[model samples]
Target: MNRRDELAANLADVRGRIDRACAAAGRDSAEVTLLAVTKTFPAADVALLADLGLTEFAENRDQEAGAKVAEFAALRPGAAVRWHMVGSLQRNKARSVVGWADQVDSVDSERLADALARASGEHPLDVLIQVSVDGDPKRGGHPLPDLPRLADHVARKGELVLRGVMTVAPLGMSPQQAFDALHGAVTRLRDDHPDANVISAGMSGDLEDAISCGSTCVRVGTALLGSRRLASP
Candidate 1:
């Protein structure tokens, strides 16, 4: 099958999975939003996906995503797409990230939140506090104890809008367990900030588990875009 045809088939299958997941969870399919992670993929592929009716896309690196955003705009002018930054973001890269990303799903530190707030200018940047479900030091998120403070910090910032919480289910642990912990955090966040209702906790592998635990958004890569390609030289 051609690449486009392959993507079409893959998208349909992923959609079916999401539908079934939502149905099994006794939730509406509209409760889950699919974010296609386009990191390492070229803008041409993104354009094709746009044509396939994907309005939301994500990237982990600012440098690559900035270029892709520009290229995508050039390729499909007036395309209404929402770009999400889903990778670890350094404080220094805040300006570059806020330039293109519609939402940032990995804000884990007070420093990063401050940086994003400062760089956001007149528009309030939508943000999700990355919560470390396993408390893994190597992971990119604030511990459960620190989440409240960080969420408050983001909510207090005029340039940053605290939208919700995000977490990656750790390896060697139950995905449901991790997501349930994340859901707990989301519950507390909503109690303080009712608008902070998003739960971005799923990926290509454990989306159903995430949805079962109240995930509002799933960041899917391989299931939609296939294997990762080496970066262009």
Candidate 2:
């Protein structure tokens, strides 16, 4: 099969998994939004996915994503594609990110939040507080105690909107456990900011577990786009 055929099959398979996961969780399938992570893939792939009805796309690197965003807009003119920044973002790159990303899913610190708020243009940028489910400093997320402060900062900032919380299940821990912790965080966030309801958890590997624990968005890459080709040196 050609690349397009492969992508179509992969997407259908991923959708099936999502459907089964939602059924097992007794949640409405519509409740979960699949975010196609197109990092490392080219604009052509993104355009094809757009044709396949995926409106949301995520990327981790600002440099690559910025170019892809512009390329996608040029390639698929007038298409409503929501760009998301799902990787750790540096303060210096905040302005660049705000240029294209509609939502940033990895605001893990007040400093980063401040930078994003400053960089955001007249329109407020939708954001999710990245929570460190395991408190792993290497993984880049705010600890549980820091979430409230960060969330408060985002909500108070005129340029940024607190959409919800996001997390990656730490290595070695069960996805259920990690996502359950995230669910707790989301509950607390909603108590103060009722509109902050998005829970971005899960990826291609453990989406079922994430759904079982109340993930509203799943960031999928490999399963949808196939194994990533290593970046050229």
Candidate 3:
């Protein structure tokens, strides 16, 4: 099979897994969004995936993501593709990114929240508070004690729609443990922010665990587009 065919097959496999996971969780696959993480991959691959009907994509870097967005927007006008900012967002570049991204998946602090708010005035912005599942202070997410305050702050922004929570499961720990902790956090978040029900906790490796723990979205990369090849502008 060609690369495109292989990609189709791989996407199908992940879809099947997602279906099984949703069934096991007493949920339906249709309710969740499968974000094909096309990070470090070329715009060509992204274009191909778009042709394959994957409307949502996640990217971790601004430089790469910005370039891809420009290229795709140029190629496909009014194409219904949603871009997600799923990495550490730098404060200085907040304005530009907020303009392009449909959702900021890593709004971990009140400062970034304020920045995004100011940048997105009058523009609808979906935000997910990123939680570091491992309690790794060096990492980018906020501490458990600080989520509600941050959520409330983001909610105040007319442009920022606090949709839910997103987290990276702790590395070197059991996947189930990590997803369970995220699930607990999500449950608490949903209590206060009823619309904040999205749990973006799974990835290519531990997607099943994430699903079992009721993850509403799972970010998958290599499993979808094979290995990525970075392209230059």
Model 3 clashing residue pairs (backbone): none
For candidate 1, the 10 contiguous residues with the lowest summed lDDT are 224-233
Mark the regions of model 1 whose C-alpha exceeds 4 Å error after superposition. 231-233
Model 2 lDDT per residue over 1-233, tens place: 98889899999999999999999999999999999998898988999999999999999999998888888888899998899999999999999999999999999998999999999979999999999988999998999767888888889999888989999999978999999988987898899999998999999999999999999999999999988864321
lDDT of each: 0.91, 0.92, 0.85
lDDT: which is higher, 2 or 3? 2
Q: Report clash pairs, candidate 2.
A: none
**How should the candidates be ordered by lDDT, best one leading?**
2, 1, 3
TM-score of 2: 0.97
- Tens digit of per-residue lDDT, candidate 3, span 1-233: 88677778888899999998888889888877899998888777777788777999999988888988888887777789999999999788788897679999999988898888888867778999998777788876987667788888888878789988888877678989988987887788777789887888888988989888888899999889776687647
Off by over 4 Å in 2: 230-233
Model 3, residue 216: what's the lDDT? 86
